[model samples]
Target chain A: MKGFSKLLKKDLILILNNYFLYVTLFFAIFFILLVNFVIPEDTSIEQSVYVLSEYEEGNKLIDYFKEQELSIRTLDSREELMQYMVNDFNSIGFILVDNQNVEYVLQGYENEKTKNLLALNIENMFQEFTNQIDIKTTYLVENNTVQKIPFNKSIVPLFLVMEPALIGLFLIATMVFSEKEEGTIKAYAVTPGRMSSFLVSKVVLLIILGFISLFLVALTTVGTKANYLYLAAITLTGSIMGSGIGLLLSSFFDNISKSMIWIIIIAMVLSLPFASYFAPNFSPALIKSIPSYSMMFAYKEALFPTGNSSIIGNTCILTFIIGIVTLILANLNIKRSL
Target chain B: MIKVNGLYHSYSNDDNYAVKNASFQIEKGEIFGFLGPSGAGKSTAQKILTGLLIMQQGDYTIDGKFVDFKKRDYFNKIGVSFEHPNVYKKLTGLENLEFHSGMYDVKTEDPMNLLRMVGLEEAAGKKASDYSKGMLQRLVFARAMINNPEIWFLDEPTSGLDPTTASRIKDIIKRKKEDGTTVFLTTHNMYIADELCDKVAFINEGEINIIDTPKNLKLKYGKKLVTVEYYDNDRIVNNTFSIVDEAERTKLNEIINKGNIATMHSQEATLEQIFIKVTGRGLE
Candidate 1:
């Protein structure tokens, strides 16, 4: 344990002294800030409906659309509503013909699903207007309360998972390659220090950096209200897995530049988790096979606690198992190469 | 402090052995040199001894224990300075020593003192990446001594240094010898083997041809003759005389007594010549 601590300290110092680590950190933080502040939030929803009406009940329909969290565009003329619907393929346009009639306008490229949803919404609005039935009263009574999260806030967890994973991958690769190039890795082979200690030291440093980046990201984007413990757990697991991958890949290359090309390639492949993040329903089984998929799923559950511990629990277990296996493989490769 | 018998090793991809049935031993406080050109099993033997390579078919012991490359404690008693400068380039010279010293369980020597011994005290704070080849070599030497190890394994210790630095390193090896540290030096430089080694093993093609002290090997392989240069009749002339024969000695003595001799010296073969003569191949 003492030897491990000493090695950990030395490696930490080396990592701190390396300029590339700071550069990677800067880019990670820059990307987080860019996502949070610079890039535009994805406010366009597929359920956007534009209403143009001369009737006095049009305000009530617009209020219902607003309550449903749909993008509502109001215009005074039917031409303006038609123009809006034509430009936005996923949008539906409604023009009031009389107190009892309404006309629906949709683009030619709109899919069947969009047309069906638009028809259902129009029928429900006509039913409410004609019969004066209060459907929301029953919904409000049963649900009691509803929680809404902003698009920017909901996507924060994905960045938290992604940024640290990237940082760990690049940071460990850079450190390992630098040591290999200088032949200091072979020096470790002849020392009293165990190979396990060396690998653990690198992993510990990566996890520490991983947590720091996660904290800054969470604090800046999500604020103190976010669950810090869950963020830490998910980030730590992701970082360990990332470091293991980095070590395994780095063992095959003698320099950073060579390893970097593979890092980019593997990173793109491992980015299957992003599909699981943005389009959870459309995610394929291949995406779930990726190690980070479990991590990203767990992060999502942690970000918005579903009270169903089974998914998060299973994801945590799988991530850890994969982490341990990769770590063992990495250790073997490092021992052989060194 | 070290012994090996019938040592053999071969890489998996190659059919031939790298060190085939090689054998040697070293006593305490003695400098033993494995003298050979590159690819002549000098490094392979050194690697086996230093625990970098596993001993596959050999009986070997160090400090009275069976050699085991898998044991971490074995490294506590040994120090290796590779031919290449293996110090961390990003670390300051002092930091590199300190970092490596922390690996051993034993009490280490002061890193600053080791730096001073290697004539690198002033540059101890500088990163190794900015150092010259000679400076890096000296720093590697300093790092090897950080643990005050009992056995020193040096591979081409003076290969890439100026004469002054190489002499300083040689002097340090001598001092270590006087301090009762067993030294296993590997080099192709015959001058180093001839000057510092108490005994040298001439190796070629994964086998040792001979092992003996430098003086004894030279005497056994060198010609027993003396060359005399004399100023005769206002012109310089030279003649070789067999030192073993009385008539040739008398003729050489008569020329010397007549005050016609300019210079007279015995012809002695060098270690390189003896290496080629014994192994049937030049060191190169």
Candidate 2:
């Protein structure tokens, strides 16, 4: 522990020199504006349903769709429906050749399950001569009628997952890569400094930075509505885990450029749960298995208490265990290789 | 004081070794030069001694005790100046030294004093990243002595430095040696080894070929000779004569007596020549 404080101080200076604080502040401001102004207060991923009809009853279907408040667009012909569907990855189209026959035009990437669901929904919608989606909808937070987080505020969980919880993955890698490039790791090797102290300093610096980012974005977006104490515990554990992964990754590769492929691959894989965050019903077992999946929901629970305090405690415990394991593995790898 | 016996190391972790049965000793204040070309395992031996590489098969001891690099106190007693300059570039030269000084538990030399010794007093406030290569090399040399180590490991300490700066670094090393610091200097530069090392070890292909003082090695492997340069009929003529051979010694004496002799000097085989003579290969 003799040089641990100096090592931590050195890491802090290096990170700041890399403009990490400025970049983090920029992200904080951007997220604040996004939650407060850009993303609407009452928004959802309600896919637009475009309708194309050759029959006269199509005009009646539009009115029916409008009355039900289904997000629908009317196309003049089948060509237009195909054009729109081809261009819009998120939208589905219904082409009605006659009153009895309706074909679904989908963007090619939709899987079999989604195509079948869309077919069934189309069938159920137009069984009574309707042209588009006719599923009964309920607005949970419209006009604050239900006890629910607003759509814009609900995005806080995903932001927390991406920023404080996982930013350390790349930041720590960058920090370690910088030291390697400078050849200071070799200098560090000869000193009386402990490897555990050196590794711990990096993790500690990231945890501190994570807290700063968390407070900046969370306070600006969620404010007192969130349980700050719980957020701190969860973010601390998440940051430790992120830094551990970064350290383990850095141990194998000499520099960031050499390790960049894996860095991006891991980053993209870890961010996969963000899709599930916005699309709750889209959770497959794979998405749910990601730690961030539970981390996102944990952030949500901390922001908006649903009497599920167990979520916060469970995530913190699980994350702490993962953080400790990865740190141990990283330490061993670094000692053996670096 | 240090002793290394039967040290062996291999990168492949197999029969092929980088260093084999390397052995040497340096008494207190003695400068031991590990001289070899690239891939000759001089670096591997130095790294093992410095604890950057673990001691795999060796009896490497300091004083009367065995060195355990894992023990923190072992590092406190030693310092290393790497071949390539490696300092915290974001920090000022002074700050870099200060940070390194803090790593040791022992009383350390003042950062400013060490910098001053290396003629980097003015650049003390400049970030290491902004330093030129020679300036960075000087800073690394300064940082190494910050701990006031008893055992110092210096790898090509003046490799990239200009003559004046390299001289300054050499002067500092001599001063450290004078202060009773045992120095392990690793280099392929034979002139440096000849000028500074009290004893030199010539290694090649992972095997140590010979170890002795530069004078003794030169005497043992090289013929005694003297080079004579003289002005004759408005032209300069150079001739080398062996001092040991009766006929060549008489010729050398005649050249010395000749008043027109512009320069007359005794010459011995350089460490580089002796290395090649012993190892049957050039250092480069």
Candidate 3:
């Protein structure tokens, strides 16, 4: 442990002197500025639902929704709803002529799949509400409904994944290659210091870097609203996993030049979760199986939690194990190769 | 302080060995020079002795403890100066030594003192990346001594340097030997071996061909010759004659006793010549 502290001290100095400190700070500031200023606050493309009743039975159908206090806008006339939908691309209009004949009017932008999904969802709700009104049983709202995530704020999870998680893979590899190029790695082999200590120290340094980036980006973008301790835990898991993988891959090659392709390849593969993060329905079982997918969602829970905080616990536990395994493999390879 | 019995190393896990059936012993305070050209087994042997390469098919004991290279104590008592300068390039000379000083569990020499010993005190604060190749070599040499090792392994310690710096380094090695540090010196340069080694081994093609003190090898294989300088046809002429042959000895004596003789000296086989005679190959 004492030896580990000494190696950590040396590695910190190397990272500081190599200008990586400046690079990380620069990137953090850039991301903070980007999230806060460059991206629009509400890029929400979710169109509002508009409806109008023309017959007496349609009024009963409208009353059912009105009692529920949904954001379903009720207009005076079908033409009025159509005008609102035409002017506002964020709106979709519905006309309940007699409940058996319903009409949906759009601004002509939604895809066929999206239109069908929206219609199917409305039809299910229509059926449920109509059944409830016929039976006349009062329904109670659930207490655990999470708040909606704003469009710009939703992108922060991707930033965490890219900066403190994915970017760390390359950073740790760079540090390893720096030591290899300087031949200090072989110098270390002759030392009484344990190789495990040497490897763990590198991971610790990367975690420190990761924490700094996380704090700067989070505070500037999300302010003091996040679960900081949970954020820190997720970041810890991410850095270990990133640095461990970087070390493992680097152990097989002699220098960064030979390993750069594979490094980029792994990073790219790990980044496949961003697809699911942006479009949740796009998630296939394969992408969901990736650790980064869980890490991305876990960071979301930490940053802007929507009550499913258990994801953070599960992701941290699983990634921590995987991280440790990679670190062990990296240690063995370095012992054999270096 | 160091003993190896029939060490064998095969990188491919097959019968083709980089070092085969090598055995040697170095007593406390004696300098054992391992002499061989490139691709010979000197490096493989030195690496094994220094705990860089694991002992595959042999027995090794350092300071009377059977060597376990995985043990921290194996490195605690030994130091290695590589042929290549392998120090932290971003660190200053002093910082490099100081960092290496921290790796050992034993008491270490002052980093500044090691720098002074290596004549790098003036440039101690300069980053090693900015240092010359010789300066970097000196820094690595200084680092190897930071622990005041009981056994020191030096490979081509003075391969590149001016005569003055090389002599200073050689003097340090001599002082350390006097202080009872066992030295395993590997180099292709015969001059260093001829000057420093108490006993030297000549190895080639993964095997040790000969091991003996330089003086004994000279006596055993050297041809005693006398180079005669004398006046011939109104100009100074030079000729070499074997003193052991009766006829050549008479001629040499005749030249020596003559008034025309200007200068004469005895000659013996050099270490390189003896190496060629034993291994049938030259040091590259």
Model number with the top TM-score: 1
Off by over 4 Å in 3: A46-142, B231-235, B247-261
TM-score of predicted structure 1: 0.89
Q: Give the least accurate 10-residue stretch of model 3 chain B, judged by summed lDDT.
A: B251-260
Model 1 CAPRI rating: medium
lDDT (C-alpha) at residue B1 in model 1: 69
> Candidate 1, residues B68-163: lDDT per residue as tens digits?
777788889889988999988878999899888889999999999999999999999999889999999989888888888788999999988999
Please give the DockQ score of every candidate, comma-separated.
Answer: 0.77, 0.51, 0.59
Q: Cα lDDT for residue A67, model 2?
A: 77
The structural similarity of chain B in model 3 to the true chain B, as TM-score, is 0.93
Task: Report the error of model 2 at residue A188, Å.
Answer: 1.0
* Candidate 1 lDDT over residue span A1-338, tens digit each: 76787788778778777865576578567866776887656676456678887788777767766776767788989878877777877676788766777787866676899778878977886676558776543352554343565677677766766765665787788888878888898787788988778887888888888777777767777677666777777777777788888888887777888777799988887776787687779778887887777777677667666554576667666766767788888887775555
- Cα lDDT over the full model 1: 0.82
Model 2 residue runs over 4 Å out of place are: A44-146, B229-241, B246-261
* Candidate chain B TM-scores, in order: 0.95, 0.93, 0.93
Q: Residues B142-177, candidate 3: write the lDDT tens digits.
A: 898999999999999998978999999999999999
